[model samples]
Target: MEHSGFLRRWGTLSSFFLVLLLAWGRLYAQTPSTHWSDEDRISSQVIKLRNGITLNYAVQGDPNGPVIVMLHGAGDSWHSFARVLPLLPANYCVYAITLRGHGLSDHPARGYSRADFAGDILEFLDQLHIQHATLVGHSLGSFVAQKVAEQDTGHLDRLVLVGSGPGTHKAGSSEDEVTSPFAKLTDPIPYTFARDFQASTIYHPVPAWFFEMMVGEAQRVPAATWHGLGASISAGDPLEDLKKIKVPTLLLWGEKDSIFHREDQEVLLKNISHASLKAYPETGHALHWERPERFTSDLLAFIHSNGPNP
Candidate 1:
């Protein structure tokens, strides 16, 4: 009887542990990996431009290394590059900026135009004494970078435009009837709208943590800024300005990009003197989010390559 009781006790203990182990395994599977949550690798800072607008930015890599300034898309902050920042080499100093009226940047009553945005960037470079640096911009930021390059190419080493088009709206679109969904947005933008908007940008899967972070970033912008930016984007085309960008330029696009089409890339190439395009297969508008490793590799190759520009 004693031996039988001991056997029963042992079986009960083993069963309890098995249940516990399975529960622990389920918990671990549900939790996001720490690899994607490594925000400690980068440092955040805020700068007040001479125009009195304060902009927030994230910095990473060597301070004394080659300079590279990144501009995020509409309604996004420097955290948009969270995945890409950690992957960059230590030899390059990167400044990923959150544009005015977005992220933690000061949102004034006006000044949402591309020209206004470009002006702030120029002043930012001057304040930091960045005489020459490569500029990387995505979507709305790409247009702003074009303006910056147009206004002054002497301060720039190279230009990279990701998910950009010749213009935000089709030619001849009136400002009042702009084709942007942001124009109709009201204060306290719906969470569903923000989530769906972000979801539409990526064809590939991203970490749940990162996707939620992006949606949160988009929700931070106010309605007035959205209306102002939407109107500004619809009011102008930067094709003429592209002719003025004399620096080596790289246009990064995704094959399945719903925003900018192949024709837009052709127009960009035709205008810029030294420009090349690299299209990612099965990627979408947010190529960086979809394939950050490939994006970083292509960016680094373009920066270091001595190959002739097409």
Candidate 2:
């Protein structure tokens, strides 16, 4: 293909969105991630940050066991990992985090970038007195987790990234949409052109109930907050920072992920040494939610094989 033809071919509107999502961290992806409930066999609490921010959190399994922090995607609460919680061994303790502005966490007026989110996680860990643990992040959470690891490499033992976006400096908009509250945020919450672009995402049989639940949850977010938070998620580049990570890592992407294309995964594997990649066939953006059994089982097997991070 000629240069212009190739550019046009690769320059689909959705393709640029794929780049934005890979770069910006937050995109409310909460499906089952409503507020923590008692019937779910989970315990909930609030982690208070020194800055007067209170982040809502939940825990499942033995509290005294080795720590495993769970981070949700953008627009989602910690409960997004609800199904995966039961699959863990009793010896492992898990804490699910709600991003500052989403879920029940306190949303400040400013400080909405991935770096801010990473700092929030650090504060959460500090409050819990959790000295060390492995970190697992999904989508937007993956961005924050990646950023968090950069802040304190010593704090993360093993890192697991699920359906993580790539590192792009651009936010992928043809015109300046940040003119207003609604314009600043990504439409599908993940991509600016998600309604049309999501076809390129993951490939699971999207159930009606899940879609409805996600849609409803997202609709509740105030337009201004959502857009402002969305703007914050896409403000910077984390690709250069990715090279700073030396910890053992596992990178997983749904084979059908339209949000993060194959090229994005290739970039990750190429850049991160000691990183392994797995593509879940028939799965889309929400790999864990779409195939809980397979995702959790694969996660368990990988962690067991690697043993605890030293």
Best by TM-score: 1
Over the stretch 1-310, how does candidate 1's per-residue lDDT look in tens digits? 9999999999999999999999998887766433434456678899999899999998877788888899998878998888888788777889999999999999898999899999999999999988568899998899989899888847788899999887646754432232368878998978987898788788988998899999999899888888888788777764676788899999999988877789889999999989999999999989998999999999989988833321
lDDT of 2 at 188: 42
* RMSD of candidates 1 onward, in order: 4.1, 17.9
What would the C-alpha RMSD of candidate 1 be, to one decimal place? 4.1
Candidate 1, position 273, lDDT = 88
lDDT tens digits by residue: candidate 2, 225-254 = 566655665564657778877777888888
Off by over 4 Å in 2: 1-40, 170-202, 206-210
What are the Cα lDDT values of the candidates? 0.85, 0.70
Model 2, clash count?
Answer: 14
Candidate 1 Cα deviation (angstroms), residue 310: 23
Evaluated with lDDT, which candidate comes out highest?
1
Off by over 4 Å in 1: 1-38, 171-179, 306-310
The TM-score obtained by model 2 is 0.76
